[model samples]
Target: MRFIRYVLRALNPKTAVTMDSRQVFRIRRCVVAGVIAVLVIAMVSCGVYGVKMHAQRAAQASQSATSTDKTTAKRQNSKKESSGKQSQKSQDNADTEDSVQAELKNQSASLTDDQRNEILAKAQQTARDNGHEPTQYTYCVAQKGDVGSLDDFANAVYRILNGERGWSRAGATFVQGADGNCDFNIVLSEARYMTTFSPDCSTEYSCRVDENVIINDDRWNGGTNDWLSAGGDMARYRVMVINHEVGHRLGHTDNETTCAGAGQLAPLMQEQSMHLDGCATNEYPLDGELWIK
Candidate 1:
């Protein structure tokens, strides 16, 4: 108002040419008011611009913070999902191991206490029967039909013959040799060819004909019903069949031995493949049947 009033007065004809002291004072006052007005406008404009700029910066910071929070949440969720999957996989493996152990336990429980104790005692005694003269025997493997890998079969045969639990503990050491050069022939024959060895050899079982130890591929692949019923698997059935047929070569007759007692281990000379006769299925030779003639 001061600046505008002074401008109006200076523009009037009465005050335009006048040089009075009062007019000079009025001009100075108007100049000061105009300078104050310019300063006030500049301050107000800068204040408004500063407020707008501050608001825009706050909005940007808010958006950035929200994005950062989302990213953190996603990382946390991903970690949780990975951890859950790993935990579930570990749990599944543990369950499988537990299931296998439970099955083994149930199979072990099928034996009577007396039979179990007797078997354990026999095993302990056999462990001490080690210092006898070792007899070395060479054997060859022959296969009929598809019996998987012959190399694997031969390896298993050698392992069974010379294994600690097999005839090896009886002081017999076995080596694989070429055909006709071996002391005995271990044959893995198909079920159809089992009877070719002799009429006594059947399609469902293994047999010994002089120097030939014929094994039924069907029984080798699938264990006997009696053995399986007695809580034995195919691997153990193979061990029993090999030892039993070879026991014939070792001077043991089939009828000479049977299950020692009810719930006792079937002797290696027993026809365990045909029947257990209420005895538990056993593969290795017992203490009394360990020596070769």
Candidate 2:
């Protein structure tokens, strides 16, 4: 600025005349060069500032992206954890069920052969001892749709029941096909030496059936077959399932008369969820409920 002022002063008419036209021309050229230099410096400063701002913006964008990635990763981790927990819970439930089923299998197994024979013998003694027959009774067979085949299955049951070790068919008989006045139709759906029912003790029960399925998906580990099937586990379940359903026909019902959500029937009925009653719980007794005067 000072140089420009000085050049203007030198270009004045008085100085121009004192120094002549050549000196005046030189002073004006110097002033113009100074102005161009100032412009170049200003432009450089502006460019540098723009570059700095751009770099700052890029850094900010990178930070924002990093934060978003972390958030997304956290959500994914949480979901995986939740899924893992659910899997663990399901496995635990299965294990608990398995334990219960194992116990039932053991109890059911003990009911066959020698043990069962002993119980049957006791039952006959009780009937003879009590000497009171049910009203209009029949060996009503609650037919199972899938006992493999009915004729063969029924014949097998007849052979087994007849050979019951302790049981005597003294007053007992097999009434086949419903005569007009059939009281009940009982079929040996599955004749496993299953459980020893009370000797001469008769229990009558009734229950409401929930979702009945053709396929057996019971809770018991032994499934329907292990209970009293003829073929194998599957076949055993088929027979057991039939026996249970037929057991209901024998006058069994849900044990809990007014339970909340069917407290499940006893084993002989559905899941074989129950065990055969001991002699004490049986309805029939050698001595009557009330003394016979």
Candidate 3:
């Protein structure tokens, strides 16, 4: 510092020839002092700048460390979630497999002999009752020998129980044809009709279970069976068959619709008079239980 100040002062003649030799020396001293002040200011500025740069670096490092910790925590959490989902999926699959296995073990294809009979009997009874029985429902089949019996019976059956109240509100009106013939008519397509089994099952057929049995015609064209073939039951033919079929309306299947048929035959919901294979409403004891309460 002294060397610098001396060089600066030596160049100034005015400074060398001061008011006093002492003053000249003072000028040189002042220059030296100024130089020292400048040096001191530079050192202080450098120290302050170094401190600020170090603080900035430290803050950056801290931020980076914090960011790294957050990244690691997120990765661990994602891994844990993935593991939990895999475990849950495996458990659900196991449950589904167990359910399928359990279901597979419960069913068999073969039916018991009793069960077969039950099915047949149930079908016959259901079909007949659904076709023939009305509370006071009647089907007009004239004397057994009449060829037009089917027509008359169809009429009565339709008139009484073809619409809604075939069983409750339905009633049959028997009308006699010119040649001692009969016909049963059905007004509604949905009305039930009665006929004998196809020898595969000898007796019951059809039920008039609905309250709305309606007849739209004076002729009996639907519901054909063999009872009309054998001329036998006489006037009872109409009533007996009606009764047997009605038994189904009261809810018994083939096991129940019985009266009597050819050769000491038990009448079921059979066109009773012709084959003596069945009975009419009068043949079966009228049960109050048969009426819908």
Candidate 4:
């Protein structure tokens, strides 16, 4: 600024006349050079400031990108962890169900020929040893729908009915007569046909209407979920249902009785199909239930 003021003073007419033409020309040249140098310095300073601003902007952008990447990675890792936990829980539940199914499979195995024969012999001897004349009750086996293996079903009925722990203990013995020629009917029918016998009968369970001892084939094959869950097998379920339904034919009503206590045998007349109510599964009649008639 001082140099600019000095140049302005020198350009005045009086000052220029005092100085020689050469000095005047030199001052003029110096003034122009000084203005150009000032402009150059200002431009250089602006350029440096621009460069610094650009560098700061680039650094900020890079930091933002890095922060976004970290956030996304954290979310992905969290999702993977949640999915892994869900898969593990599902696998554990499936494993437990499979174990229970395997146990039921092992328990459902039928008796061998020798075993059947031995049990039948003992049951017959027990019936005879009761020392009372066996009250004869002729019955017939019939089917409403395709009940699968008529012989197998008939044989099971015969064995269970005449078993030592059956109604035989009460001097009641069942005999299968010719078709349509019997005192009572033990009908093995499909689930859909169960309600046809009477409105009181249901597809979910067995029922006895008059002389018809209706057995639901579904229950015969699959058994009840309640019974199976209570550690009961298909074979024992068959025994219980047969006795339960036949007990109705022998003048017993749907008692819907509960267990005497925990760990005690459930009453054969109890609705073991629905729930055990803290009782163990039982297949035969108790002493009090033997004389239903």
lDDT of 2 by residue, 233-286 (tens): 333333444433433443434341221123322233322324322211121111
Task: Score every model by TM-score.
Answer: 0.56, 0.37, 0.31, 0.58
Of candidates 4 and 1, the better by lDDT: 4
Error of 4 at 91 (Å): 20
lDDT per residue (tens digit) for residues 57-127 in model 4: 99999999989999999999899999999999999978866875664454434557676567556655666
Name the best candidate (by lDDT): 4
Candidate 1 per-residue lDDT over residues 1-293, each given as its tens digit: 98677666665658756646577668768778989999999999999999999999999999999999999999999999999999999999798657755643443344344644454444344435776666777788888777776665665665566656877677777667894898999988889988888897788788889899988888877878888878776667777888888888988888577777888888888888778888888888888887888
If candidate 4 were superposed on the true structure by all CA atoms, what would the RMSD be? 8.4
lDDT scores for all predictions?
0.76, 0.40, 0.42, 0.82
Which candidate do you rate higher for TM-score, 1 or 2?
1
- Model 1, position 15, has a per-residue lDDT of 74
Off by over 4 Å in 3: 1-7, 10-21, 101-293
Ranking by lDDT: 4, 1, 3, 2
Error of 2 at 79 (Å): 2.7
lDDT per residue for candidate 3 within 1-293, as digits (tens), equals 98666555554786556436675677668879988999999999999999999999999999999899899999998999998999999998788657644432322123355643453344334435545342232333322222333443443333323222223222221222233232332222211222221223222333343421132111122223444344322222333344445545445444444454334444343433333443322333233223332
